[model samples]
Target: MMMFSWRRRRATRRMARGGGGGSMTELTIPSHFLCPISLDLMKDPVTMSTGITYDRANIETWIEGGNFSCPFTNQPLHTIDSIPNHNIRKMIQAWCVENRAHGIERIPTPRVPASPVQVREILDKIAAAAGREDCEECKSMVEKIKILVQESERNKKCIIANGTGNVLSSAFEAFSKPERFEKRVEILEEILSTMAMIFPLQEEAIKHLKSEASMQALVWFVRGEDKSRRRSSILVLKEIISSYPEKVSELGEIQGVLEGVMKLIKEPICSSSKKASLFITYHAIASSSNQEGFTKAFLQMGLVSLLLETLIDAERSVCERALGVFDGICETKQGREEAYAHALTMPVIVKKILRVSDLATELSVSIVWKLVKHESREDEDEEDGGVKVEALQVGAFQKLLLLLQVGCSEWTKEKATELLKLLNNLHRERLECIDSLDFKDLKRTF
Candidate 1:
């Protein structure tokens, strides 16, 4: 058996050399010189609880990615804490030094890992700097925090766990007044940029910035040219408004806030910015009392055309959100009138019924229902001019039937059925009365 083991290994080696049975030079890297996790020479070697060693950055990344087990052992880790493997690091360094003539580069010493205590100290320094009149110190501290956040996702979690968000919110609240906006624009921008990086902000932190004056400052920030600031501002705003939906009405009262949100919806700068703007718009008109004001502002800003444009090419999620906001606008009499007035409004809405998602389908039906209901009354006053005629001519009724044929929520099916019946009634009335109408004039009007 021993002779067979030796022969088998030798045969494998010979085959690896293209079956030439010739001598081949292959370098074998020392296993001890490499990290167990990365299988690369360790620059900042650290040992885990399972007695296996890995590079520090790789382990931290593993931990941040929600792994709590040793990669090699596959055992549930008692604790993720790791200590520097100084001896192994030194050995790797010496090996690199000895192999310098072979083109290996010396590894630089790794910086000491940040501890919770060190992070706490930095947070205090940032708080102190923010309180001081010197914007330079505050800016410096913000830059340092940004670096720490960029170092590891764990660092971001650490800073957030230690009330960094609250401290930053307080600093922003201090400059919430418009009087200080110009003077503190740079510092405020830095703070906002930092906050944007730490997303899914805790409700507590959002509440700190949800005050009237603080929210006003955020609105002003959203209107800025810096797209990063705008993104951060809108994200924060979306979180806050989502939490306290009742407060959305007051946002419409803020000067330039509605317009700022509308501008984002009109020409989305980024996907995130566009989504944030959609959330803000949806929330603003969510309340019945606020719909009148928002509808007026939206129409004045030409959102009907913008929404139609957005719906045509937006991704499914953005399409759903855009449809939601459009439906909200159409709930009001003014909104319904404006939407019906747009030439492409009903057609675009009809196109989205089953093409997007279930939510989008429902919103489209609701908007059509509103338009149809309003136009039914208008048809009584003027026989030939109504959304029903345009919708029928544009094949909206056929889409409605297709909507019913395909499965949807019970409410959607019921609504579509009702709209179908109304459409059929209108079609029958038109056919019965066709003998009295002029065909040439009908073609011109349509």
Candidate 2:
């Protein structure tokens, strides 16, 4: 629509400069260039049953939304068949190339939509190849399926429509069989790869992949030697865990799963894998009934220092997930003690209040709140009281006060105010400098 409006103005200007024929090129796009529905130039032009031409995707979306009438004709459509208009497409491509100097890009030909029959055929091939020792054929079929998935959204819909999800679900179950324990590494990799191809489907398809056997197979892949498989496994697990939080308990039961998760956090893998590991850890620690055992294992795995180091990474996703895991773990007494023992823990947590996103800011405030609350109840323990003093020394007072000064989320504001009050009540004489500097502002707000 914007392009049409611009072309209209340009055409008016061209007509006003009567026969001057200057060096400036005319921007008069053909009237027939636009689609009737969207008013945008058609890329993959298709003729409908009503003899109306529209872009394939736009018309498909219309049909999928239960629109039976033709968009332009206002007539009831007999069928939804959209035959490709090859002549119009070729003309559009030629016109685009001719208008290259005017900043128009040539549209790439749209990939053919995967038919249901073709999808079923490919699924059959994949299923037949899964049982054999030589999985080269299976791998080849998966590669083809991946290409089809990457080609277009229509192909993904077609594959999902043809029950490809069950194929992948079956593959996961087969990979988990005890008899397949001595299988070749290539076969296992291919199975994981096949799942990865369909991993981006809808939730209904993803739900089909949540069996116990599949979960175990994924845990095996997470601890496997192949980096790519490990990466895929972590990503898939992240999606599944987010969708089904109850599965976290089952995932936690697998031996070495937690260790593998911690290993992923410590390794120099991609940020996605690290984020997934952080989420899995967060869910496990947050929902586990045995807080003592979970906290002991987490601290024993050296998550405190690893999380401290991760805070220094500049990626926001990594930072948000790291803080989430950190917040969940710090709820336990052992976790709190471990965090306090880390030299950089307090400083790093305070520094992230405004440096990262608001979510990070809230989590950081919660961590400090929990730490201070823990210390507040332990009046006799000199070591516990020392944490509050250390926090003051590291400028926690100033940071929390500043957090209130700038308008943050209501929760963050409340937490900061509470922490500040705790500090003010504990050491009234020590906070005189900060109070005098911003006393009126703090008094009015609190």
Candidate 3:
């Protein structure tokens, strides 16, 4: 047998130190008994669909490395994981024992990889345990799957190969239904942790995760007190929401979905969590059904104050996302009212004009235009007419003027022209009214 160079050196040292009784001898390994990929003695040989047999670990590494063809013949493979070659394994083992004097160690039988059937059986038991009183059985079963999932990539593939990903999704769906959530919160938390560990979920899993029940459950976990669970939940939630493009009004069904998701943006567990939170908010309002209704929900949750705080302190990407959502909020009359209600909305938004990214600038300009244009859009004027007044007070005129001078998108420049015209009209009106303020009986008017 051809041993590794390090192994040979170790044996030589052992013999020199009078520790080994026999000197090592070199032996030529047989060609057929070796793995073609590694050229090493076959240990746990498995045959691929292409009819090529290789050591189990080597072949698995090949397939997992994104190869879909045989290593030696270059033929495409129909099946992913290879089947165990029992006969070759037995012969390899017998040959190892017969060549004991040649320093060959007999390969033990390989443990069977966890199969989809096994995962299905455990899932059935878990579903049955949901009705029973004691959850210890459920916890143990989930814990077992958790361990198997962590064992290897092959195990993860085997476990969720079937539609059992949906089973786990439904298990997480318990959080949405309070009656079902009574005794299963702990179990659901465990399930969240397990699913988080095995991510990049298949299509079947994502289908249910986008369902109303799972979305609600995900929102709860994102806002939940368990810090670890929140991290896991957001990681999974971001994938589900962003991976699927079609969003619907089912978002409106959740009680505090907006509030729960905002918690992530308000106080993120990590950078990714913050981005995911922003992604959820941006995506939630993406549905036309969610716009008028859920924008009101966000406003009720004090989204204006939260967004201003984020713009002041967040990084470029976060600023872009927060501003994106804020722009969406500004599309509605109530959205404009809520923003105008906030003390620093105009001032802070003006600050963002030239400081952040161009997208941020565009979003901020859009919001300014909406707030100022509400008079024209609704044909109604506010009691104070502060949209134009506040715009001037916050140096918004100069910023918009600077944005125009420095140049921007045609859309932004056009909005800036309108904003400058609005601000200038207000400036001229304020100047024109200055002389009347000195008169004793002057009536103040905008």
Judge candidate 3 at residue 196 and give its lDDT: 75
Candidate 2 lDDT for residue 33: 68
lDDT of 1 by residue, 1-446 (tens): 01224445656777888785765443334788777777777888989898888988888888888999988889877988888988988888887788675456889877665568877787777678767655778778778888889876657777878877877777777666677668988887888888888877777777778898778888888777777777788888887887888888887788888888987887677888899899988877777776777778878888888989999889998998999989888878788777877889977887776666779889999888878876646464575657777667666676676666656788888888888877786644443222222222222111
Q: Candidate 3: TM-score?
A: 0.59
Poorly placed runs, candidate 2 (over 4 Å): 1-29, 37-41, 58-80, 93-109, 128-137, 182-184, 200-213, 376-385, 398-417, 428-446
What RMSD, rounded to one decimal, does every model reach?
8.6, 5.6, 11.7
What C-alpha lDDT do the candidate models reach, one value each?
0.77, 0.77, 0.76
Candidate 2 local lDDT, 293-396, one digit each (tens): 76688889899999999898658888998998889878998898898788899878877776777798899889988888886455425754566766776677
lDDT of 2: 0.77
After TM-score superposition, what is the CA distance of residue 105 in candidate 1 from its true location, in Å? 9.1
Where does model 1 exceed 4 Å of error?
1-30, 33-44, 55-71, 74-76, 86-113, 132-134, 380-385, 426-446
Q: In model 3, where is the ten-residue run with the lowest total lDDT?
A: 431-440
Q: How accurate is candidate 1 locally (lDDT)?
A: 0.77
The runs of at least 3 residues in candidate 3 whose Cα sits more than 4 Å from the true structure, single-residue gaps closed, are 1-121, 124-134, 152-160, 172-180, 198-224, 230-259, 279-297, 341-361, 375-446
Candidate 1 or 3, higher lDDT? 1
Among all windows of 10 consecutive residues in model 2, the one with the lowest summed lDDT is 435-444
- Tens digits of per-residue lDDT, candidate 3, 1-446, equal 45557567777888889899786665556777899999998877889988889988898888879999999999999887678999988988998899776566898887778887888899887766654534777778889888888777778877767555666776566444666664667877887888777766877778767877677677677666888888878878777866774553565466665666788778888887788788778766666755787777778888889889988888999899998888888888788888877888987887788777789989999989988878453323555556687777667777776677677899999999998887787644442122222233322232
